[model samples]
Target chain A: MNKHLTVALDAMGGDEAPAIVVHGAEIARERFPEARFLFFGRESEIKPLLDASPALAQVSTLIHTDDVVSSEDKPARALRRGRKSSMALAIEAVKAGDADVAVSAGNTGALMALAKFILRTLPSIDRPALASLLPTYKGECVMLDLGANVECDASNLVEFSVMGAAFARTVLGLQRPKLSLLNIGVEELKGNEEVKEAAEILRNSDLPLEFAGFIEGDMIGAGSADVVVTDGFTGNVALKTAEGTARLIGSLVRDAFQSSTRAKLGYLMARRGLDGLRSHLDPNNHNGAVMLGLNGLVVKSHGGASISGFATAIGVAIDMARHNLIHLITQDLGGVFMGQSVEDEAPLSNPDKEASSR
Target chain B: MNKHLTVALDAMGGDEAPAIVVHGAEIARERFPEARFLFFGRESEIKPLLDASPALAQVSTLIHTDDVVSSEDKPARALRRGRKSSMALAIEAVKAGDADVAVSAGNTGALMALAKFILRTLPSIDRPALASLLPTYKGECVMLDLGANVECDASNLVEFSVMGAAFARTVLGLQRPKLSLLNIGVEELKGNEEVKEAAEILRNSDLPLEFAGFIEGDMIGAGSADVVVTDGFTGNVALKTAEGTARLIGSLVRDAFQSSTRAKLGYLMARRGLDGLRSHLDPNNHNGAVMLGLNGLVVKSHGGASISGFATAIGVAIDMARHNLIHLITQDLGGVFMGQSVEDEAPLSNPDKEASSR
Candidate 1:
């Protein structure tokens, strides 16, 4: 680990800013003792919290910024007018080489725009993708392009595959991670033109990743692949849908336990076992969403994440910085593109004609 | 209820076709005593099963058709070459007015293709959408188009809203169902061109259904809206993702209860309450997916559904037929379009430009 590794924090972002940010940083400091912190927010609001944690205060530098990117602000507006906002300043810190990474829990659109504008994407990447780890039955898996690019073409999906595989290697520590394109069906002939075209290219190419064929949404939680790739729109919907379902089941279980005295007693006796299940499925255990393909590391925590969740996001940012995720992505791109532009690759000669028939 | 409502069954479809099909018919007979059955498959394979259920045999007419559409057959291939298959014959029965509705536990692509070709679409409908009821915290909600149309234009989505609203009215008996377009965010400026355009049209038009504006995927399971609409690819992924999450939770719950002897005793005491939860989340309770906007009612059951699951599918078909789902959709479409075609409606002058910026 770099002794002087620094992380910039958007302390004025998120639903419960400053407090969560300060407490989260303190928690993260214990895990990554060598890491330094740069807090950007209203000094008046953050100083008292920082003072409470003397150790964190000693290693942290607070930069005052009253300007904040509001939750309702449009991305364009945020990018144009939020130059002095905490979110923007934190990202700028990364660009200025003061901080190795930036972590925010602000509005997703605003965060993406600022990160892209400040950090810029790697030379080989057209658009950076939002990649996150989701809990599966067999531990966890990484899914990419989660609301980053709503409409992705063949080349864009191929780029996501490379970036996603690189992310898995850095975070999940899986070498030659098995990847699959998210589709409606597992059949080779299913899905739209873009997915079918992307699959054809990946199948023929000698990319360093294992291109497992198309996977259905139902198989995602079964850990069918290490990396699941899709256009932003579908990925976003799928991810949110999974979260919603988990909440629904949790609510139903609570209702069931309260239905009868016997069930209530059962819940008491089974509390320990259920607690393990709860922790395993908790969002705090997996909170970081990295914007892959960016030149500098940028992690987005959930807007409503607790202190622990925010700390987990910080840990993710530190891990990416330590592993050199950007370098890894560039290397993976070099292996496949091989001095040729993505557009220069041969187009699919015969895309699946029957895809749109139904 | 129609005293002579007849349903055509594709007896050769599904993983365990002949037995599940025959047993499912017996179960449906108990619910809808007025409904008759026309079984289309090989009489030799189906006779013994039908004979075992004497009551179902009394109401069912076995029609011999040796040919069957395989699950692997492409939709286009099935449309061209599967005219004599059991799936085709069953849909033909609906086209010939021999049955009020057609129910099939078969390959979705093949079933959709055969239904579209044989039964045809309504005059005002460009493409039929696949709609299904999903269990939610508040009863159930309807979602579409679950892989019927991979890519949909603004007009197609508008048409789906009308069709979905009608389906909700028929099945859920809501006078003015709350409808929402599934997108990544609930903001007015979020999502792609087609979704934004469709939302604008729905907002401005005097459609019978209550337009509840945009909804995120996480709100779907909370029953935030009565009808949820999206393009086929996204809708399909979201539905499967929810199912996958539910199954994951179920597996986790089982593992938790079996972790210790005390937990096992708790499970024994809580078995009744847990059973209620299991039945509530069971796929068997919601097995049918209807091809909305077709001239005739066509319901597709899960290919791997058990006897009870297939029975639930038949129950769904009967409800649609009884409530006249086709006529309701025609009425809803007529009210909105009036004499003007969907294309003639003014297009979105200023679609959200920031949609693709990120």
Candidate 2:
């Protein structure tokens, strides 16, 4: 394991560009003194910010980029035209082994496309999955395929299970995570063909993980499993729905506290305790969403993330780089494909061919 | 429209069967003085419960049945063997015109299977959908296909949109509900083939309802649209995820209030305001999940519903019955199928044919 980690930052990305990137790297630097940064952005904007933070400037190498990928740019467009963009350059650094990992808070689609095109997928991985940590009753659980592939086949799901389990092991520090497929119902007969097929495959596999048959959406927050796996479409909807519900309840709580004079007084008295609860549910606390199954690590920070949130994303990349996430995923995938024929694995390697054949 | 409504109750269903049914009927009778009830269950158990409530007994007729559907029974097994069961009998009453609506708190899959088989789908409808109200920032919104159809085609999504819109109109009292398809993203080219196809069809159609394009899951709680439509699998997951998130936050709030003496004192002062918030977000307040697009109204109450929650389910059925929910759906579907040919519509009417063809 390399004690000195080098992280490439897309300095021009995110809602609050250079300022957030500069400040966030400084915070991350304080925590990880051995870690160095390569910032890719316009020299004019990043230089001023770096000048303000002498400590961050000392350990960071500023790489100038004339262009940046906008949030509105389609993945295809970004891939075709954003070669010299900060987001693309940061990913390129990882691909070229100049940096151990890349951290970005830019357009998700653009980042995903650029990362896939540059870093490429590992030999055993069919598709890369977007995995993130969600706050649950029993601390936090990891869920994957947030929005990477809209439609996933049985092979894709099986591949995701391996990658997600590997991620939980690396990030959550679990030796053998309890993994489950997300279905409409926990029953054996429930859900679509793809989910059922994946479950059957997992049940028969000799993987070194506890395969907790199936779990419903409600059980996700209750921490029924350490790793929750699903197709991107359902996973994306479930994740967003959870976010919306939390926000709705949060607003309602605020409204309640302001409804009456007594309530206002009560809120003042309970402010400290409520603040603790607030931080626990805060998105910034769980900001990093990693793109797993790639040849190199790429951690995506929320576009609207706070300074600490971006730092958390950098922290995720550091952990994965130090822990050898790519190597772990490669070894896990080898176990998955041991019993399968080469013909069964051919279609999943190329998504374009798979789509055209379908 | 029926001025005098008759509701059939599956008295053998739910966690606290006869007691919740009888007490709930007593409460419903107060709200709708002209409403009558038909209780189907074991004579010995229900006779004693009905005997305790004279007012409810006067307006209710107990129909003894020996069989009941267990919660663990699969849908196929329940349909094959539960012919004379309480849940089947309740649906039969609706089919026989002995009841305007049937309310059950039984196994959801069993209830859906029996209701679909007995009542059948309306002519223009392919499948019946499970519709429910969810609390949102701007009051409440209706979401459909909660777990009815696992994999829906483009036409099925269009049907859900019409049924969901009709539901919002009849129950929520909206003149022309703002309807939207649930997708991974709000963009036109964002989701899978089915969603994009449905959106294209809707954009070109002449339906009376407001087609607000696509909405992501997070927008569901923001009340971005009055009627949110999706396939059964995704819809079910989203609804449950929202429920789970709300419960998670609620528990955290309780923990915050109990953390210290000052927090406990603050909770006492804010008790009244917090009570109002609790009721606003209470599952009991939004208990009923209606099986929409059926020939007759069938409301499914939560198995763990309190007396008030069961009454709320009855209230929903009463509203649907009185407003002629079937007729509204029929009229709405007429607008939807105005342009399509008969050959294009044949595949949807029979789910068996649709599945076999697939």
Candidate 3:
């Protein structure tokens, strides 16, 4: 089954690309030996790196592309002028059925734009959302719309809930994912109109999803829900805030350990356990942000991620393709519950229109 | 200087009220010997606790009241029926000039509602905001609107920036506080309309504030700016997420230390330094979420806060009242830069209306 899977790579993307990309593919190839790859970038730059990885070279095809999308390029500019760029071509591979999934660690805006433009959104999805795994006390949870579609309507939120549930089921291997809307408070009447309306829809809907009601930010780490759905703005802020807090705590821990001679000795004794803790909290262990709602799967690795991180992202793509996440989402969206007329749906662009009408 | 200050206490507020509030007052009294207090709540419950602390009792006057607002009480109900309640009476002390500031660890929604209705808002401010100090690597930063106004316009955010700057100057003791609007991206064109418009106003304004442009959530702990401003919804989520992350990391560290005999020994050796770190990051040490923009000073402590936390909140109230934060904000608002006509101001209620008007 893995032999049929083809992963497309945007080799010219990220801060340290082609080299890290090839090395990471080598690591992924070792773990997923049956998977094949199509590398999209300049042949001169990518060929040498692939040659260094004999095993990766054996299972990969180098698709030459001279044009590259700069990290500084705006999403609009990238879309209009980057038709031949490595990132665009890589996404095209997924659209053309040459690859089961496409992965990039390039400019997030450009990737989202190109992916949305070329692959298009799923029939039931108005816009694609960025979803990533967050390590929670109970295990892990998925949060969506990390930085896509900042202003979302109730219908858009409901769509995100559906997408998040599918993602949790596929990636987290959950029987039935409990989904919650991220809000200022867990109370029914709290938060803005969009969240309240979305909750109302979810609570009343006959969808297969387990509607877990509203959840506060503190509950994200407490593992209150399998999937947390939010507008891009809140999700982005929460995700980054969590990251910043983690980093601050980590530095504080190190500072404490180095404050005294006794603490230095303690550090030596606790080095092994500390290493375990570090690895557990490492972003590389949880790499791969899947852009859900697209017609085809497109996984994004962190631009500054290491070989291990990139390999983890590849693993996510492999799992997603194997599980047929898109198929499951389509099937779920096509169900009897989703056959309700568009009048019940709110346009994400004009959320206030719904508010006024309601 | 504190001789003129009198703090109003909602003696029945908080999870462990009466006992905790009384104890906290004693602690604050010891810290600020010149400060006096007017405690509002049932005299039967508070008299004994105050009697235990003779020093606090000498400086305190008990205002008997049988009514108490429960944590579950809605804001509207709290405002309408809580006139004789402890929380309301405590706020009334500030309004009636009986206290320099009022401190409560009650239901945040109710406190805000009652405070807004009784205290009223400053002429330059359309809505109130919640501000709190967050520990960062470079020391500390002030973030606002923690959860006061759910939805804000561009003008409200600009106002928040002004308020947050004043807060940093007063509490954090910064000479020229660097202020930034919290956004998903730091780019000029990124984020929702409110944030983008707010950025434009700040960039063009001649306010004394060092408008540092947009900052993402991760920068909050990096000390990218002294003041971080955002709408209440996003700010609340980010703040909670940061707190949740901190707790998760703390637990993980403890788990690591207890994993093996060596780590246990390490924990013992590093106890002193770790204690210092703990105190620095402790919520009690940094307690106080001040409701800004109100005519009177009001500090809201966490309902679950300990005596130390409540004492810290009282300290914040004292500092704000002493520094004349509201006076400073009023002066700042009356400056030449704020003379721009109301046509430039965006309406908070109907954000979409502004979208079309522009």
DockQ leader: 2
lDDT (Cα atoms) of all candidates against the true structure: 0.86, 0.84, 0.84
Badly placed stretches (over 4 Å) of model 3 are A342-358, B336-338, B342-358
Q: What residue pairs are clashing in model 2?
A: none
- Looking at model 1, residue A292 earns an lDDT score of 89
Candidate 2 per-residue lDDT over residues A7-43, each given as its tens digit: 9999998999988888999999999998999999999
RMSD of 3: 4.3
Interface DockQ of candidate 3: 0.51
- Estimate, for each residue in B21-47, the C-alpha lDDT of model 3 and write its tens digit: 999988898888778999999999999
What does TM-score give for chain A of every model? 0.93, 0.92, 0.93
Model 1 DockQ vs. reference: 0.45
- Over the true interface, candidate 2 deviates by an RMSD, in Å, of 5.4
Model 1 Cα lDDT, one tens digit per residue, A244-267: 888888888899999999999999
Q: For residues A93-199, write the lDDT of model 3, one tens digit per residue.
A: 99999999999988787888888889887876777788999898888999987887778899889888888888887888886899999988776767789998999
Sliding window of 10 residues with minimal summed lDDT for model 2 chain A: A349-358
DockQ of each two-chain model: 0.45, 0.52, 0.51
